[model samples]
Target: MKILTIDTGTTNTRITLWRDGKAVSVAATQVGVRDTAITGSRSKLDEAVRDTIAAALEKGRTTADDVDLVLASGMITSNVGLHEIPHVLAPAGIADLARGMESELLPHIFSKPIWFVPGVRNDVENIGLHNCEEMDMMRGEEVEVMGLIERLSLRGPAMLIMPGSHSKFVCIDENNQITGCVTTLSGELLHIITHNTILADSLDRDFATEINPEMLLAGAELAKRIGLGRACFNVRTLDQFTIYQRNDRANFLLGAVLGADLLTLKNSNAIRMRPGIDVIIAGKPILKQALALLVQNDDYFSGDVTVVPDDLQPQLAGLGAIAVARARKLVTP
Candidate 1:
């Protein structure tokens, strides 16, 4: 049977078609509506969603009716997308996520069968005894992670990090069940610093060419001194140097921002998973460099780091896996 999966993220929307236990076709588009004003003004996002699915279907030589199952994860079920479903708290298994989706978000999408993966949540206290709830949610990419795991028939505790607007570190135990996870604001911070903050104009749009060790070190040191609020301005202030030196400065600035995110994740008790674990860094190509930089700088351990090719869209893999599991009744409804 063929399955269609949709992953709507903060910056993009992706669709994938799977058949006979393999991905047959895929399509992606930048459909994320991070700005409240833009999301309110237009159904452009909805149109993009339709277009992405259409492209996938065309490439896969299939239609919506041909799909036996449909699965979705990400912001698509939030107040912003086709529906608004609140997150189901964690210590949750695949069954819980499947059931939650079946009951809450599926009825509107398709009557045949549909699944929505719920985000994981945990409330923990540490350091100052502050009560904080860390929610690890996936809208579209949940299907991708599940699909990848299913394809590999992986049976062990594995850590998967989906880095983007909201970076998530998801943990799956040996039974192929999601145990617990953490979310970081790395992507949002990058967007805010580069676009909204005064630093936007100071840095080049192409960040890939501007990264280096010296810049990373300087950025990390500056962040430690002034914090994120003041660091945003330093990007512009440090731009007085020659063009050759500007790249290093930009790299440092970016590194510091990413470092802050890693520090937050490291300190939070919400992410209590063991160290020296296998990590799958999923997302765009630039993320590979970012992950490498993080490790090189000792932001996170470097051992056993596997960078999954961005070729297979995570949402598609996830939705296709859900569809297959649902078809066999392997996943509880």
Candidate 2:
């Protein structure tokens, strides 16, 4: 089957052309929902989404009519996206997402109808600012989680740590369903600490090319002990008093930021975390490495931890898009 998968995020748009369940060509652009949010117009996003799909097809030497299916996920299904589709409730899997998938004919974007996968929400009702910490939702990560399950052939319950601008920790059941999720803004906070805080110059306003495990854990332990407020100031002190290099300091800062994220994992009721659930950290190598180390050090979990191979990482969403299509019976097994 020839498939066109589009993934839209806050700062980027990506399209992948797949044939027989393998990505043959891929295209991406910096255009994203940020443009729409900034300008209060979807023209730029619409144009990018439309053009990126066309560009991917062209790169694959095919056209829309030749495609068997087109799938769109992420913020594209939000109100500010191409078409808004309400979120699917949690405890969802490929089958649930398949049932909730909305098909629409948008002539401006594609020749055939595009299947939009709704994101998953923990709970969206009856909130009074109390017991609200358990609520979480995800857009594009649902598809990626499906892809991870499909690719890894996961049968037992597991937790997925996808670190990004907004990190997501997705919980899955033995039945291959997404039971719950926990989100953290560690990435966004890391950005602010590095670029917009007093510690910027201490680390030279850049991320570490190569991080130090020792420094990283030192920061993590410090955050776990004194909390982030003082831990952040520790970055300045480490630079001013200690002889750690720029990369080392950067690792310390990153560790401190992600350490707080680990706290969210321990505190989140939405995650439904249990003992012996395997952990898969999918993202940049440095991040997964750091996160894996932290998870190993903490007493919260006692299961095997694995990092998604870099080569297979990019194909996760596309693999997931195919999984949804298969679940919807849009294609043969």
Candidate 3:
């Protein structure tokens, strides 16, 4: 089976062609739903998806008609995407997502109605000021969780940490269902603070490429004891009082925010975490390393922490899409 998977985030879109199980070729573009949100039009998003799919098909040496299945996930199912699909309630598994899948055709992209995988949300029935913080949602990470579980043969109850623009902490039940998720915008917040804040000059307007264990541990520990805001201010003090390089200072800042996120996961009501459960952190090297190091150094969930490398990130969503498609039996060999 030839499967094409499309993942559209807030600022980028990726399309991959998969034959059976392995990825064949991919086409990505810088444009995504952000353009739609900025201009209040979907024209750019539509063109980008169309062109990207064509490029992927061409690069894979296959025509659009030869493809048997096309699946989409991520913000592409949000209101700003090509089409909006409702979210499935949490406690969802591969079968739940497969059953929740919605099929729709956008003649501009493909001849077949692409199967849209529904995102997941916490089961908070009514929104109120008293219990507002207990609600969270995810666009594309659930599918990745399912794929990672099968890919790594993980047993639950496990906590999956996916770091990106919006980092997601997903908790899977013992039955391998996604029970709930906690979302944070620390990645985007770090970007905004680095370029737009007073600490820009002190820490330098850049992110850490390498792991500085001391600075990272220091920031995380400080954040644990004090608040995140005050811990961030310490970055400036580190640059002035200490002889650390700008890169190390940036790592300190990285640690502060991610450390705060770790604290959130531990103390969050959005998802209930059990002690000694398995924790998996997956993302770029910088995030993966920082989180793994924090888990080692700190009094984190007392669970076994698994760190996924950066090399396998490119095909995660594709593996997920293919796996869920087969589960639904939407298209069979």
Candidate 4:
């Protein structure tokens, strides 16, 4: 099947063209929901989405009619994005996601089925750090989780650590269902602290910024030894003391943020209570960070850690999984 999968995230929007369950072409734009909102309105965001999709398809030497299915996930289904689809509660499987899938006809775009995959919601009380019943909803990650399950041929339970604006620790059951999840604001906080806060002056947020392994290890060690709140000031102090360059400081800050997030999860009821669940890191550069920390903190993470590159684009796998489930009559279309 020819599938077009779109992911509208907070900082970037990506579109991928896949054939027979493999991604053939992919494209991305900075026209994310938050970025678009700063310059224009919802209509403009929709236009950007449409244009990006067209651009991706054009790159693949195909047009809308050539596509058999269009599957969209991520913030695109959020209230702030293109359309709002109610979330499917967690402990949901491929069939559940397929059953909850909503469709729309874009006569201008294609004659194929366009599905908006619903996000997953964890509404169980007191499941997270707060010790109070807090609801956590994830839109795009659910699809990725499904894709990971099928791609890896995983059975029994698995732990997925997806790092992004809001890193997620998700649990997948033997039946390929999202059992539960925890969201950490580590990425957002890292952005705010490094770019918008006082630490910005000491740290460089540039593409050329290189990772300093030594500083990275040091920062992570500090986070583990002294806690994040106390260790955070060291980013500024080291810079102020001329102990590291601006670029090196950026790496250190990143390490600290990731280390803190890892420590929190290590001690959280979600991870500490569940032992021996294999871990898979999904996404890019952040996967490297998580891998380093996970390997170093062996006592906290006893299971294997596998890093899956972003090139696979789990959203596409997830869409195909749901589509297959629907075809097999495992779910109501």
- lDDT of candidate 2 over 1-333, digit per residue (tens): 899999999899999999987899999999988889899999999789889999999999998889998998998888888888888888888888999889999887777999998899896478557768878999999999988887777775888999999999998888878888989898888988999999999989898677688988889889989999899888899899998899999999888989998888877787867767899999998898889988888887899998888887876877887789888998778
Off by over 4 Å in 4: 35-41, 108-113, 125-134, 206-214, 224-226, 242-248, 267-273, 309-333
Q: How far is candidate 2 from the true structure (C-alpha RMSD, Å)?
A: 1.2
Rank list by TM-score: 2, 3, 4, 1
After superposition, the stretches of candidate 2 with alpha carbons farther than 4 Å from their true spots are none
Q: Lowest-lDDT window of 10 residues in candidate 2?
A: 123-132
RMSD of each: 4.4, 1.2, 1.4, 3.8
Per-residue lDDT of candidate 3, residues 1-333 (tens digit): 888999998999999998877799999999988999999999999999999999999999999889888999988999999889889999899899999899998998788889999899999977898877899999889889877887888778899999888999999988899999999998998898788888889866888879999988888888888988898988888888988899889888888898998888888899987768888989988889898898777664688888986666667877787788889996573
Candidate 4's residue-wise lDDT over 1-333, tens digit each? 677888888877888887776677888888777855676567666777788888889899888878877777888878777767988887788777777877777654445656787888875664655653345678788877777766666675777887777888888877877877778898788878877877777776431155677777777788889888767778889878885687677777777778877765666654332557777777666545545554555576677767776566445444544554454453345
Write the residue-wise lDDT of candidate 1 on 1-333 in tens digits: 687777776677777787855678989997765532364843676577667877998999887778776666777767676555666555555565566674333333344455555554553335243545453455544555666675556555777777777777777776766666777788777877766666666766435364576777667667767886677567776786546365665686677777676666556566665666666667777666676567556645644767776665444445444644574474444
Model 4's C-alpha root-mean-square deviation from the true structure amounts to: 3.8
**lDDT winner, 1 or 2:** 2
Cα misplacement distance, residue 234 of candidate 3 (Å): 1.8
Q: What clash pairs does model 3 have?
A: none
